[model samples]
Each structure stands twice: as structure tokens, then as C-alpha cells.
Target: MHDAPLMLCAGEALTDMIYQGDERWVSRVGGSVWNVARALAVLGERTAFAGAISRDRFGDALWAASEAVGLDLRLLQRVERSPLLAIVEQGEPPRYFFIGDDSADLHFDPDVLPEYWSRDLRWAHFGGISLAREPLASNLVALAEKLKEQGVAISYDPNYRNLMDERYAPTLRSMAELADVIKVSDDDLRGLFPGVPLDEALRQLRAAAPSAFCLLTRGGQGASLFHGDQRADARAPAVAVVDTVGAGDASVAGLLHSLARHPGRSLQSHLHAALAAGSAACLQSGATPPPPAAMQQLFELLEGDAS
Candidate 1:
């Protein structure tokens, strides 16, 4: 395993309103990249989060949660505005409703990045609504460019929120070119590429970003990994799903953790680990990530079964 920090997540930090069976709702700190960062931390990987949060109670909760999960918060910023919020709906196909505008997350300024932070990270992750918003989107793109120039591995998950304007596609595509690894859900790919077939969409995306290792996640079906001239697919194990929230983020974290722990492992093994992490997330409620031991056990079992 590489001793270097495995991941750096840069994006929005917000709260999610989760329905608790009854008419009541509970507030939980969540954001795509934030969830992934927390998952990575729980798996005993060195991880840091770089994003803007409000000075409000919600932001405090987010910070506390991040700290609890052992994610480095030196790069997190606090602003006067309130953080973003999302309402999650549970059904056959889960849905999300983003609430709030012009919040702290959209105000991220690249100049605020700490000068002392090392650029030698193994992976830097950015995406979600942060890639769909204004100054934050531009700021992340700039940061990704800088990280790429320094030869740092970049991971991106365009966790596309419907709240974003459709006009952001150009900017999203432009930033996609800078990522070394790109993770996307089937829903996100459909939204980004519209009526194109999955393979055709991937072909177009690969052409736009030739060097990226692409991962296409298909919810319960499984996920596929594409790198160089190779492609590998792994089926997600069946589990009693409590909520699908944060599943994709968990998968991203798992992929990063596996890569960090077993650097030269095959692509199939990496995809298997990611599937296990995501499946574990489905077994939990709210945006809470699965425990480290659970993730490891899932990976071991899946690998054994595959072998």
C-alpha cells in the first residue's frame, strides 16, 4: 500500500433531510464527496476534504461528522451563508430534491486553498452539485487542472443533481477531461449524454477524456470498469436495502481505499470492492457510511466467491 494520503474530496458539504418511515424527517450531514471522504476515513485510509460549509448549525454538524469519521478538515472553509440541503425520497427508484440557493458551497474560492498542503496525494475527488454550480465549479476545474499538472491522480463523480442548470454541461465536459478516473451512475450518464446508448456514450466520453479510467455504475445490476483497452464488470451482491442514499459515494470511497491498499491489484478486484461498499451502503439509512470491518469483509467474501 502507498503511505501517501489516498484521497482528497473537494466539493459541497451539506445536510440531507431523510424521511424516517413516519411523517417526520431527520437532518443528516451529507454531500457526495463528503460522504466518500468519510467512507475512506472509516476504511483507515488517509483522506482530506476541501470544501465550503456554512457557519450555521448544519455546517457544525457536518464538521463534527467529518471529524468523527477521521477525515482531515484543514481544507474545509466556513462562511456566513447556510449550507445546501437535499430531501431524499424512498421508492423503487430513489429520487432527490435539492433545496437552497447561493449557499456557501457555491462560493468556494481556490485562493483559499492552504499553501502548506502537499500536492502528492494518490487521488483527488471532486464532483456532485459542486461541478454544476458557479464559482465552485470553476474553482474545482482550476484545482483539478493544477493537480493534473502535478501528476496527481484525479477521481470525479458527476453526482448530477436536478437543481443545476442544464447550461452547465459545457463546463462539466471541460472538467471531465482533467480526471484520471471518472465514476458515474447510469442516471448521471443518461442526464449527461441524453438519448445515446451506454456504449456510445462511453465512447464519446472516452474520446473527450482519453486518459481517464471510466467506471459506470448500474445501481442494483452492478458496475463496470474501463481502463486502457480493458473492461471489467462485477455484480453487486443482494442485500436488505434500507436506503440507497450515499451508495455511489461509498462505492467511490471503496474503489479509492482498495487502490490505496492493493496498488497493483487487478481491475476486477477493485470493481468488486467498490460493489461491496455500495451494497453495504444500501443496507444503511440516511447518509451514514458502512463500518470499515463490514467493507473489508464484504470485499473478502466477494473475492472468495469470485475466485
Candidate 2:
């Protein structure tokens, strides 16, 4: 049997068709959970990606990209179906319209995961549009429960989008309750609780998942972490704004990287690394991770800031 990956990222892996100019479009590997898994591997974590991929050209590209990033692909299953496609317009906040229903991404089978995978995994991460969908959402929740029972840490990013507003609250509460760490954006807060104040919205989320550390990310303003009687915040580093495509995913990866090493460190330490990783991702385009040298430079800069 293959050794277990330190981290398992479960959810959708799809192709994003990004608008460039008047008529030009570019397709890239895109999905919140996939992005987090890829970023962790790029940042040198022993990570595995768990998602349903099609056997089509787009899926081939996605799989090849995962291999290039050194992500363990054993958990990636292929099927005969059209790939999920997202038409992304790089607006101020970036707009997305997903194409293709009943695609392979939503067909992930929890039972297919290797029996030994639970033993080697230190952490598992899930969320995004995957949780808003049908069978996959329930599958992921069950997987999280199983992993939790096995003593594996679970992280969730409610990277909530308006497209998924309907299922937002219940799913958020569900995953947040099982998560060891939960990351939410200011936007997610608004979407989850429109009339409530930011603090109140956050309080509601905390109440639902009292045992988890909830990290609230205020894009550009930085991020904050809320735990039991513990709070920490950090400012986003200054970087050229390329695109905020995968900034949150990168932040999750950074936090996971730090947690894998210093799981018991203060929230402030984790936030610092997370902010740096998130900011560094904006220096590139299309959810691609920064080069190791760039990440190193950013980390050094963060260290200097702390000093």
C-alpha cells in the first residue's frame, strides 16, 4: 500500500475559461479545493488531491497539472463525462458562471478512497461550490466525519459565492461544526448573513462551530483568526495586483503548511504565514502558485516585518 499523504484535499477540479480580451479566452485548472491542494504541494507539503475528474481533454490537463505540481494523484478518479467549466470574467471582484451539470467533479465516490489513507492523513480540507451541490456535498461531510473519528484534523473554507447562497447557511454550519479550522471571507459573512453586522455574523458562525478556529479574511485589508478566547489578525502584504483568483486558497495552503509543522503555535503566527501566501498568489495570474524562490522571498519579508 502507498503511504498516506499528510493532507487530503477533497472537492471539485474543473476547467476555468478566463476572459482575456474582446474575444480571447484561456482555460486553466480551477476549483477551490483543487487550488488549495495544489498550493500545499507547491509549498512543499505532502499532499493528495481527491476529486472526480473526467477522462476528457480538460481532465487530462487538470491531472497533468496536478502531477506537475507533485500532488499525489492516487485519490483522483476519472470518469466519462464532460468537464465542469467556469467562465470567469476578471472584474473588480471576478464574476463566474459555471457550465456543465452532472459533470465528473460532482461524482466523487467517498468509498473509492483507499482504506489506509486515513492512517497517513494529518489533515483534510473541503468546501466551495462542491458543498452547495448534491451528492458530493453529503459525501464530503461523511468523509469529514470519518476522518474526524480517525483523529485527523479537518479544515474548511466556506469560500461562499452568491451562486451557492441558498445552501450556504446549513452547509456552512454543517462543515464548520466538524472542522478543526474554518476560513471564511468577509464576503462570505455578508452572503451568509445579509442583515447582520460583521461581528454578529462571525459570532453566529463561531457559535455553530465552537470547537473550530474561524479565520475571517478581509481581502486586501488582511485576515483575522477567532478561536476560544484567542484572536489574532494580520495585514495583507503589498504586492502587485495580478488577480485575486486563488488568494484565499493560497492562504489556506499557507496556514496548513504552518499547522503541519507548528500545529500548536499561536494564531498570530499562522495568520502571518497565511497572509504572506495569499498576497504572494496575487503576484501571479490564473491561480498558479508563486515559484519557491518567490515564496521564500515573501516569507523572508514577513519575518522582517515581524521583527
Candidate 3:
């Protein structure tokens, strides 16, 4: 058994219809939280995913993939429906088309939270379509509040999709209030705070979630960390780009892994590790995270560069 830090990820778990050139599509198990959970597990973190999955074959394959990646499935709920599928397109900034209507993932119920699920978890993460959908949105928000009350560190990634209602602003604000850490991409910031300048966006986010440590990601450039009066930014090492699907989630996992392993390390250390992890994911073709060895190698390189 590896001595890995315990993490709880709550949100959507589904399949991705990846565009493989001209009009060709391939199915791959993916979801924002799923990608984050998989990345953490692959990096040797003790991880558990909480979501309602379908009873169909796609759901079974998702469970198998989770198990194979070492993610605990005790909190997974099964429904008799089908899972969500996202049609992904390749471009400068990849676009996604979600083909889910009342999918099982949207049916996640807080009442079904297992008794052993919350205990021992040091960190909990939730966001993406999970926060934008129905019943699950409310359920996930309640879960985050409970976790915060239990003194567990909470992280949020608003992997926003356009399907969300315009009225979702309040929900986003509320979630930001409860999170101990918040991760957002430049696109997310623009979408959430339309017309707001970058600096003002960060300032407003900090004002909204006063206690939360915020990280703003810039796709190919790298990421920025904002905490108290301290701020750190790093540019990702230039690498051959393969796919950008889960790079943001990979960055979240990397940041969490660094914080869990070296609690109270300088902000620069966290940013450096996160950039490395995210850059490594770009070297792969799918949403699956890079191996632990790859993460370790990048960490070493970052450390060397810092020294």
C-alpha cells in the first residue's frame, strides 16, 4: 500500500467522443473531476471519486478504469441511465459539445453519501458540469459546505461549459466563498466575469473568496498563484503539444499533490510543480494523466531550474 494523501473528488464522470481527424470519433472515459481524480491517483495520491454513474456498459468501463488507476470507488452511485458524452474538437483552443440530457451524473444525491466517504480526506474537489447541472449542483454545493465545516481543505475548478444557465452566477459566487483553493483558466475567468480585466478579475475573485488561495491558468503560457499579498507566476516549459484535453485538470492535481506533500511550501514551489505536471500532460494524446515517473522527472527538472 502506498502512503498517499487522501483526496475526495465529487462531480461528473462520463465518456468523451474524441475527434480523430475528419468526421471520425473515438470514445474515451473522461470528465473534469474524473481527469483530476485519475491524475491524483496516478501521482500516488489516495483518491476517491463521488458521483452517480449509469448502469450501462460505459459506466462499467469507467469503474474499471478508476479501479485500474487506484481510485477508490466506494462513493460511486449507479443509476439505470446512460453516462454523459462530450464531443471534443481539435483546435487552437479545443471546443467540447456535450450530448447529455438528464444523465446519471446529474442525478447525484447528497443523501446517498456513504458513511465512510468523508472521514480521513484531507482535501475535496468539485466543479465543472457538476456545478452547472441540476440536482447534482445543489448536492455538490451542500457537500462542499459540509466538508468545509469538517475542517477539510476544499478546492474548486470551474471547468465551465456553455450549457450552464446565466443564473449560475450566484452558485459560482457561493462555491467560491466555500473553497479553500480555487483553480480557473483564463477562459473560465473571462466567462465568469465578462468584460473584466485580468487584474481586476483576480482582485474580484479574491474579494469574493477572501480565504481561498486562487490560481489562474494561462493555457500554453503557464499559471499564476495568488495568496495574501504574495503572488507567483511561471511559464510552462515549451514542449511538443499532443492534446490539451486534460491539461488543466492535470495542473490541479499537480498543485494539490505539491500542497499535500509539502504543506506550507513557498508559492513558487507549488506553481513550478503545477506547470511541470500540466506541460507533461500536453505530451500525451488523451485525458489520461502522465505516469508518476514522468511527474517526478519534471519535478526534478523544475527544482534544478529554480536552484
* Clash pairs (backbone) in predicted model 3: none
The residue-level lDDT of candidate 1 at 145 comes to 84
What is the Å distance of residue 240 in model 3 from its true position?
2.8
Better of 2 and 3 by lDDT: 2
- Predicted structure 1, TM vs. truth: 0.92
Each candidate: what lDDT? 0.81, 0.85, 0.84
Model 1 misplaced stretches (Cα beyond 4 Å): 1-6, 19-23, 89-96
Candidate order (lDDT): 2, 3, 1
TM-score of each: 0.92, 0.95, 0.94
lDDT string, candidate 1, 75-170, tens digits: 788888867988877544667677767888887777866674745577898888888777778888888888878778888888766755568778
Local distance difference test, candidate 3: 0.84
lDDT, candidate 2, at 193? 84
What TM-score would you give candidate 3 relative to the actual structure?
A: 0.94
After superposition, candidate 3 runs with Cα above 4 Å error: 1-5, 89-95
Report the lDDT tens digits of candidate 3 across residue range 1-307. 2333379899999988878887888888989998899899988889989898888888998999898998888778898877888877854576877877888898777786666566688999998888888778888898889889999999999877877657788788888888888999888878877889977876887787876778889876667898878889878877788887789999899999999998888898888778878878888888878667776778778777877
Query: Candidate 3, residue 147: CA error in Å?
Result: 1.0
Indicate the worst ten consecutive residues by lDDT in candidate 1.
1-10
